[model samples]
Target: MDLGKSQRVTRSEIDHILTNRRWSLFDVSVLPSFDTGSDHRLIRASISLNKKNFERDTHRPAPHKIPTFKSADLEPAIESNTWTLFEDLTEDYDHLVGAPLKCADASRHSQPTTIPTLNDRAFAFLEKRKAVKLDPNAKHLEKVITG
Candidate 1:
């Protein structure tokens, strides 16, 4: 972090805690009382029936390769064909529509509605093959999905 710039710098490294063994994670039990003098709680991981459970709390955190925001070079057809939705970006509704409206000016020549109409939704669903909240009797399945 450079103090001259007055900007806080942060970095993250994916430290590999697991070995390349035949065992896989079955269940994780966090031991809160067992203190190792660190902010992190001791996690007792249980593997398959063949393997034994162990606490990797004693082992030093080995830093691995930095996880990259990777992108693959796609074909022209596939690249042009791709389409992303606005709602799926955030789980919260206020952040989705309200945040953008707050930044935008109402004095502009054209002011679009926050919520898209059914016709616009239907068109996108048919043409772009975009996922939509399509229910016959009900409107949104969010409540049902959460329940």
Candidate 2:
């Protein structure tokens, strides 16, 4: 069949059969071409059915029973009171939403701030390290080995 007049065209077709034995195929044919802006042709089929007695419980299985768990088996790692204390420490929802300035305010900056140089970053890192007091006389190797 002449599916289309395009220079580069491809044909696509599908065939299927009904699983039910009662359904019978009577006739099959390729339908007339229509201006659907597509190259694939359509197909039409005629099918007939013969009524048969269908037993409800012939091949069907019984419904499965879902397993139930006891309330004692669902103990969480953290207690409810501890969860409430953690929740209280968190910032308010409204503060979190309103914390950041709008995009328009951020884009309207008159002067751009200069980023810190590598030397400046290194100086800051060294200052922070010097501020942290370490016990020089403590047995660091022995503590790590024991742990």
Candidate 3:
């Protein structure tokens, strides 16, 4: 064992003996000529032990509660007596539904012309029906008119 170039050190047989049964030495090395300000040379060893002997915390925190609302809670406002039906409200029907005849007067230089095509009238009627069907307030208006 070359302990160092300047100083030599030795270990006894009793120093090499293992005291504990759980601990086992894996490696042993001698560090020489490293200036640590001490005359004695440094020796290092790797050891292994069983980790299953230790205890650990496995508990988890509880989940938080959140508030939610149902459609039934909103039904009172929809069915209220004060709710105004959209059809009962005053609105210019001819102006709201686009009349091609009305556009003839809008131009000063052009002569007033009427839409003679039955196909154009049918298309306008279909468009108005689709608009009424898609309107959310139209349901309440229909209920007031029919009943």
Candidate 4:
């Protein structure tokens, strides 16, 4: 018997096919034929065994939890102010020089003579520096970024 898109097959159609068989429907899938501008269409059906039966009969045991660790039973670590070689040097230099100096000019001065501690001075130097923009061919999705 042919089945159309609007037609619904009853449960008897399934029972008739599995009359002598002992299989249970674990899953059912149907695939429809791709349209090539044709009136005739084809469908495929697949059936598999139920997964619950195999899982129920398995001998695998669940994991057990250990209670060795308790939040109240643990001790906290002790903190110390012991100074290392690098820490001592860094603190001493911070007190003396305050910050690292950068060269203002490449042709006139090879190295900066003074260190700048202020953020405004560092930002001013960066603002005066030249920067490259994005490539012309680069695609930007945002409307504001397109320009």
Best by TM-score: 2
RMSD values, in order shown: 27.6, 27.7, 32.6, 23.9
Model 1, position 100: C-alpha lDDT score = 41
lDDT of 2 by residue, 26-124 (tens): 676665556434455555577664444345324566455443433342232112212222244355444334332222233332442444556877887
lDDT of 2 at 108: 38
Count of clashes, each model: 0, 0, 0, 0
In order, candidate lDDTs are 0.43, 0.46, 0.48, 0.38
TM-score of each: 0.17, 0.21, 0.20, 0.17
Best-fitting candidate, scored by lDDT = 3
**Tens digits of per-residue lDDT for model 3, 1-147:** 334446566533222335344345667765563543345565567766545532222334444433233445334433442333356335445433433233322322432254345787787876777777777788877645533
Q: Against the true structure, candidate 4 has what lDDT?
A: 0.38
Where does model 1 exceed 4 Å of error? 1-23, 49-147
Scored against the true structure, residue 7 in model 3 reaches a CA lDDT of 57
Of the pair 1 and 3, which is ahead by TM-score? 3
Sliding window of 10 residues with minimal summed lDDT for model 2: 77-86
Cα TM-score of candidate 3: 0.20
Model 2 whole-model lDDT (C-alpha atoms): 0.46
lDDT tens readout by residue for model 1, 1-147: 112234344533222247554456656566563333345555667655432233453355644543232123223323443244556556455455654443332222342434355787677546433223343444355435422
Q: Which order, best to worst by TM-score?
A: 2, 3, 4, 1
